[model samples]
Target: MKLASRIFFAYLLVSVICFSYPVSRFVRDVRMFFLESVEDALADHATLLANTVGTQMEANRFNAEDLYLAFDKTYSRPLAAQIYHFTKTGVDLRVYIADTSGKIIFDSQSRANIGADYSKWRDVYRTLDGKYGTRSTRKNPNDSTSSVLYVAAPILVHGKTAGVLTVAKPTTSINAFMEKEKPRILKLWYVSTGLAILLSFLVSLWLTHPIKRLTRYANDVRDGKRAGLPPMGRSELRDMGLALENMREALEGKKYVEQYVHTLTHEIKSPLSAIRGAAELLDEQMPAEKRSRFLSNIRTEANRIQDLVDRMLKLSELEAQKTLQNVEEVQLNSLINSVLESKGPILSCKGLRVTCEMDRDVVVQGDPFLLHQAISNIIQNSIDFSHCGGTIGISARIDEGMLLLGVEDEGPGIPDYCRDKVFDRFFSQPRPDTGKKSTGLGLNFVREVAVLHGGGIRLENLCGKGLHAVMTLPM
Candidate 1:
């Protein structure tokens, strides 16, 4: 299972285990608790009745007939007492008087047992022996709910024990109350369990969110995309993330330096060879025109080497940076116009006409200097590739919350084999006019700048005979 699932299930299991036992015990003991309360009330009634009966006996006016009449009246009276959830319609109290000999005298519930021997019954037997007594007996042998609780007190006449008065109440009403409340108790348990589950799920997601972000960052880096360190709160994970970022930079910096050194050396070799050959020739005696031609060749090769080194330095600086600095809002139209003006002499010399299709209000957020350099590099590439007297197109527009800036040149479009490598460092095609490759860092630098601005760059072959470079930036 996934980490979140594991966490959620683990938390839920613990919560359930912690909650199950106490709830079960409470549910199991509730009936007995109710019975105890009922028993206490019954004891009070028995004692009071015993005293009243003892007074009657002392006056020689003790009468079972009076008790029978009073109990009958109580049972017959209409009662609609609503006790929380249970309703009481009539009294369920029963009283029986037993003589000192443990023989029943008055049976309020039924007269059939008026003279029955009750010496074996705990309540009657103990009360007659001058001890406090109570007992519970089930009426129906197979039904536990049919149990009745009995409490007895000694009847004393003038401080002499005379008889026993016992009060009884059936547990049917208490059971009914329990039965009515069982579902509500279970419903509360269910609600508590559901809330626990929801809390577990939320906690798992909250704990794993930072890990997911860090994983995405690692994947992006593995894919060679520019990705920044993800935000992780003040925890051990944040410390680990910073450590990982530092390690990645250390490793990438080493690899970057090695690769650049190899490519730079290889690129400069050809120009160095040309300069060496030209210098050797100039050292020999030669005609003025030949000497001048050799000198120009040497200057051209030296300039080529210088240009290659300059471009490489710029690309290395850009690659080393993980984020942009000097952020500001840049007006696209104004920037593009400046790039075009900087290349005005070159455009005039090449006899190229530039057409711009863009709104004046287009703007984006980024480092102005980096934006200018990236755009200038793209325009310069187009200038080098375009045929003399050909037209170049520049356009900018906002689409889907992105600024799409495109530059197109009416030159031979990129070859199919070279298409994918156009944006690769030190990968370039021969310019259509010069029949020579550039330093090959221009498009790559443009791509880096786009990524720093939270955007991307792509090159596409125009229909029939041209190349288009599109840079997309968040607007």
Candidate 2:
């Protein structure tokens, strides 16, 4: 089966199972509940009628004529009342009376019931023995709907048991209500089930969409095409995409190393050529001032080469380590403070002011040395870019169970075109004051630290001025 269909069926099956059981049980229970309510109301009516009949039963004088007249009058009256979903046109209740000796005296529906021996009837017999009594019987053997309900109450005469009065109602009318309600309930259930299935289908599509994008991106990578990570919502699928991207990078590590070596060699050629040319010029006879200038040029070119190699080595070491070692709980506030204190002299010389908005106790679990170096590099970049008397901001807080550390500097912000490349290895923008670019490995190293600590770092231009670098680490 195809994926969409598989998910559709799986979701539908589970939803149907979950919905059908409770709905069916509820329908059945609802029918029974209505029936019980009817039975209770009939019980109360039967007792009240019996009490009225008992008052007319005097010593050796059964005023059965008046009782007969009452039932006759009651049955003759028309009932045009509408009771919710059903209508009442006439009395459906059958009232019967049996004496203490179990001899039937009156039956509302038939003449044959009068004077009939009804003592053995459960409703009559049980009520004669001072017990609450009821019974059900089918008028037809093969017709299940012919079932009738009977409720009986004792007739009391001068505080003595007199006879039994029974009231009966057929199930046919009650079944009519059940039959009518069944289809309506089923209709509602069908509508609900259809809606549920639709929602599940849409949810399935939503879930699989990201995986599809990831698959296409992987295929492009396999085809030797350059591709970046696909955008994804915040979910487990996003995490899986990240892991896949990391895996792809690891798999191409050899090619990446070769490319790095080629680029490093290409970049060092200019400085190396400058140094060698200065050395060659020094070998010839030259004025003292000219020789000294050449010597200074050689030293400056050599130092630039040394700085490039050192930065590359540090970045390479960071990239090679898959995980942080000897992790400890390092307080970010304290770490930033230490870095600032170490660079206090430089800040003062540049007439720069640095302020911190951080609690003393905000901490993270990471390699303290790496985290310290990452923050130091960020601060150094801000210090380098900032103009004289510029203000640098450092702040820390906890967000969504992660530590958020932000560093801001008031300087000429990065250009829009260079924002995306800020964290790229060996890509640097010239500083505003000196118009000189350092080896662009600082932000990249910070990014590696973030990845190792299961976190992330982002550098963006602040609104209306400067740049802001924020690092987030899991708590």
Candidate 3:
């Protein structure tokens, strides 16, 4: 009816089927095994008694009182308590001597049944005809059903067949004993089976929880959320998690590169145009001082363009590499300090308040150089856009083994439409409000770093206002 119930019933059904088969087989085998063992014991006892009776028959002769007396003395000897069923039950177990004509002359229980013809009974008939004979039956006359083991051997005097010695034991007691043992054995089997099923269920739950978490995290990532990957154990699930993380990294890298290229080209277009126009102006006759200034401007623009191009190419190469060559544990707080130190001159000149809000022990696995470049680019972008005394916040935290790096600025936030293209290489503008132009390669470089680290980066408006750059990397 319901999923949980269905699963429970399914498990129960399979367990019952699997458990029932072997247990049923074992029960049957147990019954038969015990039956055979008792039969062997009875046969051995019967053989020994038969020999004693034969000796008595030889000494006491064929007379009724003498044979009966011999049977009495033979059974009187100490033997296994299992041999006596007559005193314990209504059924009689006894020895009998019959002649070659199949006429019984002596019986331990009664002589009345002796003169009665036993030619129809297999044991007496076969013994008279020189063959081994055995049969099982109830000893009581009124009781038609019985389980008694009987064996007959021919008595020999001077190498000639004289009479038959029939030895028997009633097995009602043994049967009852086996019946008593059945419930306990079944109970033991059931207890063990229940424990096994419970253990399997526990193990299944332990295995399924991580997979479910991974599934949810994957879906969130697909929907463009900053969903963190779960911590994984050293098992098959861990391997699967690692593989998914790797795939995410590749997709993120490709996406970052695509955006970076578009922006880089856009930003350089303005500088290239300015340089081209300036070069054209120089071709026309002009004052040497102005011409020299024009040449200097051209060289400066060319150098600026060259630097941007080199950085972009290098970032692209890093993104293309699926696996980082130099991987090590990098501290987020410490790395942030390093980037701030590198930009110390600009921070001082711009009067930018760069605040690092990093957890003391935040760590991630990635290339230190690439990480440095990515974070540096983000901070540099903030510096370029910020007004005097503008605040820049660089913060890092870890969520389920995924490092979340945030770079925020108090500068004017990105426009809605342009937000999507900001990561593209060369895609920058002279902020109409700030009247400042950017190389645009900064965001693109940050994007490549995200890809190379098997992670992703996004630009969003911080809580109320201001721009926020959030980068996610596997820790």
Candidate 4:
């Protein structure tokens, strides 16, 4: 995966882990706090009902009918237990009244539970003994939901305790409410978690996309392709890209100016010498024929210098051009043939035989004029180095997505010591026949052309023979 994606996902995972525990704890606390509020409501209702029953028994008006009336009234409300009314739901709420002798007087919900002297049952027993009493349950016989709460108070007559009135209500509603709430709470958690995950995924993709673009742009720069950055909002990443681009332009500009000055001087030196020699001859008062010829030679050399300067400047300009809007795919074979046709007379005059072996329809995309000059320079160099009546061979092919263009000759090869410096600006080798002559900027210009096209060039001695110049370009 990409670096940006890796970082984003890592951050998402850490954030989720860090936040999840707190959210879970808060939900649990809220549930417990709410349940406690409901529990408190249930407890309060039980206390009020027990106190009302105890008051009636103290006035001696609490007979069996009074007890039944009390139950029916209590049963009308939530968590209430009126023994006679509970038969509709087939549930039982036990009520026991005990006399001062600890004798049971009334048991409504369960007949067997009455008159057995529940003076021993905790709620009745404790009230009879002049202590507070509350909810109690026997082990459930039929269901886990059978737990009950009991509230009891002392009955009095003539300012003395007579018996106990106990009220019981089953704790069924609270348990049922809890069951219903479980799924609802889980549904809420599910929705919240899904939204969290979705938001995380989108944010992760957005944050990382620009960084991925930056990595690819860096690779293009390393591969010597046209590389540029889009404006991204992130300050640090944008600064890094701008800095790299500035450094590359600064280095290229420094090297280009230095090379331009050296090649210009080298190119003009020959013409200057020719013009100076011609002027000296004109001073000697020579024959009209030779005088006119010398002057003509000066003009020809001046034109040669001018052509070299123009071609070199064009190559340099192409090197720095950010956009290749004029570029297109052209057949390499046809282009090479055109350059060969242009050099035909020169090769013929040198008594050189040209051998060509290029695949048909070998194509490359580039600026046509620049590509033409690069190939022309290499072929011309081969021709210049070949012996009279010797052979200059040109060939091209594709290897692993790269187009390989080569020129070879069967003349004396360049010495190994000078081979490394052959393509440096203004570093020329001596002409084989004419001693020290020939401009040195040709190979340097060819190298620049290769770089502009995201390609490369190298010169090496052909095996057991003359010079071999190779240019490799991406197809």
Better of 1 and 2 by lDDT: 1
Q: Write the per-residue lDDT of candidate 3 for residues 164-222, one digit (tens) a residue.
A: 77877776766666566778778977896797578557655665678778989799778
- C-alpha lDDT values of all predictions: 0.91, 0.86, 0.76, 0.74
Per-residue accuracy of model 1 over 1-475 as CA lDDT, tens digit each: 9998999999999887777777888887998799889999999999999999999899999989999999999989999999999999999999999998888999988999988999889998888777888999999989999999999999999999898999999998998998998998888889888988998999999999999999999998998778889889899999999999999999998998898889888888888999889888888899999999988988988898888888888888888777786899999899989999999999999999999999888878999999999999999999999999999999988899998999999989888888788888888888777788888888999999998888999989989999999999998
Model 1 CA deviation exceeding 4 Å by range: 54-61, 82-87, 100-102, 117-122, 125-132, 141-144, 156-163, 179-184, 287-289, 397-399
Question: For candidate 2, lDDT tens digit of each residue in 329-434?
Answer: 9977788879999999999999999888988888789998999898899999999989999999998888889988899999888898888899887788888877
The all-Cα superposition gives candidate 2 an RMSD in Å to the true structure of 13.1
Q: List the residue pairs that clash in candidate 1.
A: none
Clashing pairs in 4: 135-150
Candidate 2 yields a Cα-based lDDT of 0.86
Ranked by lDDT, the better of candidates 1 and 4 is 1
TM-score for each candidate, following the candidate numbering? 0.90, 0.54, 0.67, 0.65
Residue 87 shift from truth in candidate 2, angstroms: 2.1
Better of 1 and 3 by TM-score: 1
Per-residue lDDT tens digits for candidate 4, residues 328-424, read 8888989999999999998889899888898887889887887898899898888877788999989898899999999899878888788788877
Cα error, candidate 2, residue 472 (Å): 41
Candidate 3 error regions (>4 Å): 1-60, 66-93, 101-103, 110-112, 138-146, 157-162, 172-281, 323-334, 355-366, 394-405, 432-439, 447-456, 462-464, 471-475
